[model samples]
Target chain A: MRYEVDWSILARPELAALLIDGVRYTMIVAAVSTGVSLVLGTALAIARVSGSGWLRWPAELWVNLARHIPGVFWVLFFYFAFPELLPATWGSALNGWTSFALAAGIVALSVDNATYVSDIVRTGALAIPRGEWEAARCCGLSPWQQWTCCLIPVTLRTVTPPLANRTIHNFKNSSLCMVIAVPELTWATQQIESLTFRGIEATLVATLFYVTVALALGVWARRLERGGYRHWRGAGAVWRRERGELARVDSRR
Target chain B: MVELISVTKRFGERTVLADVSLAVQSGEVAIVCGPSGSGKSTLLRTLNRLETIDAGDIRIDGQSLYRSGLDLRELRAKVGLVFQQCHLFSHLSALANVTMPLVKVKRLGRGEARAQALALFRQFGLERRADAFPDELSGGERQRVAIVRSLALRPKVMLLDEPTSALDWCLRAEVVANVRALASRGIAQLIVTHDLDFACAAGDRFFLLQEGRLREVDNYTLACCAPEALRGLSSVPRGRLQAVAA
Candidate 1:
């Protein structure tokens, strides 16, 4: 069978706009989900290692559940079964909402990625010597101070490669959202194929989008690992500000 | 003053510290000698409440650590403990590593902390290495920074667990000099080490910990068993301030 590739479908303004919207939404979901997962996943990681069983058990259960289930199953479950679990008013409202699919995709992807992110965080935390934690404690740093300055930085530095891998995995996982009619890049490709019978051209554009973004993030993550990028501008005085605040309270003349 | 009255600690079925009682007075270098696993480390940790005692009480400057309403962070600030491995926060520079506790625990302004830290760094001759990270430093340098971190808080008592284990003999004299400087300032020192040579250098009130039991031991007896006494070894490099040590 001879394959005929048609590029005419993307030439029209409206069709082009649809693909652009798909790209935009896909990036938004990836970015927002990554941010949410980073914070929540790290918290879960700390809970998993906490001395109290009350904290550890719940975090462990979450990681285990997410790990055992496939990614597509989670997306579909969120899109289908999750709303029914909510209160009737919210459930029905969400079901009827125009952007419900995208919302569901973000929630599903964030948590699914969070489980893996937590594991990465846990391993990174464990990799640090216990002596470092003890050193901070003996110096009289509060639990919050220790986590922010010492623990978080070590975890971020040590697990940079794995974190980057996980993030790219998350971006790829956004494709799963298409199953719920979220109209992400992959869904847009399928729509263009159905309408114009030009599946190859649409699929090519979608693939390029995924590859470029994923590659760029991977590069950025590597740079982050090597200390090639500093996230906070004007963060130099942040610690000094903490000291200044302390001085005001304690009357350091 | 620091006092441990009938302090006992157990891990599962094993008693690591048993009814161990001791005191360290201001400006005194109280050394505890023990073989590996004799609970010397645990004794130091107990003073700072890093290792919870299964029985008895610890009093730092006349206040019972066991009593409620005690600000643990403030208490810890008054009693600084350094680990055997130096354990410098690897992510931070040497200067930041020392200043973090000052900012977080001591609540000192950056100006005050920086001034104090820089002064100590100069006193200890570590000013050149302030910006270096832990991995960038030698073992002696790392331990010195750890000491600086503890000193920045101006603790009433400083406890060190096997501090000299990480340093070469040449560095040991330097460390001993630093400890002497700290002692001169009237900060009580409780050092735990099995190295008789190192212990003797600071053993003003030398003691021994054996099988969880602790008792005062004499300096001459400890010097008899030093490695140099056995094999005539003097690892302390020549021209390494032997006169100052004398």
Candidate 2:
């Protein structure tokens, strides 16, 4: 079968509105889910390495289960299974609400994304030299202070590239909301496609938007990496210059 | 003052320290010399309770470190530890690393802590490198920064585990000089090293550790002067030293 071009449908004003709304919804879902996942994942990462069996076991189990389960299953579970388990009146209210889809999407994405975030953060924490921990202890920092003041900053810097990749993955995964009839980019594109029988046009534009945003984010991350490298290099050069001057002065003496 | 009473430590079936008892009086500088795997590092770590003793007790300034009714954080604040590999905080500037404990643990105001940190950095000849990160400094500079980071808390006692063992020959003197300066200020120090030269130059008192037991050598000058005795006390076996020098 041959595909037919539909340029008229692509030029419609209503189609643009749908695309704009879809983009806004996708951004919102990704932002909230990312925030939740970052906090939850950091706590889980700390627990896994805390050397306490009580904490490590639960954190490990949570990460493993979330990672093994499918994202779509989580969305369905929250949307369909969770309300049924609630008390009768609350369940009814939840099912009747217009915003239930958005909430379900947030929960689904947060759970799915947090496992990867925790894994990234755990690797960063492990990579820190053991000497750093001893130094913190010698300085009399409490366990909380050690984690908050010393560990997190170093871990975040080490893991930023991977963490940013996860954020992009989370953003793309927002497309999964289409299955639940959430008005995200994919769902809006499908709505436009069915109404006008111009699926190709809507699909192309949506794909373009996603690719552009992801590339823009990647470029920003590269800029950050370059800036960090330059700062460290300049500092290293200055140190070497000072050391050389001191060496020269000693030689003269 | 820190005292260890018949402390023993075991990992699995391997015994590291066996019924070893020692006392370090206030303002005393005691250097511990032993071979690799002789439990020298473990012994020093046990003083700070970093490694728990299997038996016996460690007391810091009349308070039992291994017993209840003592605040471990307070005890740790009073005792500083420096490792062979300097563990300056990678994320913070040298000044921030030095000042972190003052602000976070001691609750000093930011301005006051900065002033104190700047003074310590200057004292250690790190004033120019105060704003540098750990990765930005040389190996010698990083070790000096590590010493200043420990001294920021003004701990009464300092425990050093092979502080210069990881340094090159050129960098070793700078670290040893810093340790000597700390000792001159009347700060009690327990330095664990296998280097005969460092032990001779930096130690006021020397203890030879072998097979998990310690024998104090009271006359350090005589010990250093007599090459045979010094070689026997050193972790390096006689044949290996001859081979390396030859």
Query: Model 1, B31-92: lDDT tens per residue?
Result: 98766777778788888777889999999889999998988788889998988998887767
**Per-residue lDDT of candidate 2, residues A1-253 (tens digit):** 8988776776788987888899999888888998999998999999999989999999999998889988888888889999999999999999999999999999999989999899999999999888788777777888899999888877877887998899889989999888888888999999998888778888988999899989888877766555553244433453354445435534765
Error of 1 at A148 (Å): 2.1
| Model 2 stretches astray by more than 4 angstroms | A1-11, A225-253, B166-177, B219-246
**Positional deviation of residue B6's Cα in model 1 after best superposition, in angstroms:** 1.9
lDDT of 2: 0.81
DockQ of each two-chain model: 0.43, 0.45
Ten contiguous residues minimizing lDDT sum, candidate 1 chain B: B227-236
Query: Which pairs clash in the backbone of model 1?
Result: none
Per-residue lDDT tens digits of candidate 1, residues A62-88? 899888888888888889999999999
**Tens digit per residue, CA lDDT, model 2, B1-246:** 888888889998998888888888776789987667788888888888788888888887877886667777888888888887878877677777777789888899866887787778767778777767788898778878878877888888999877776678767777778777887777889998877666667778888777778778864433443344444444454665465446
How many Å off is the CA of B125 in candidate 1?
Answer: 1.5
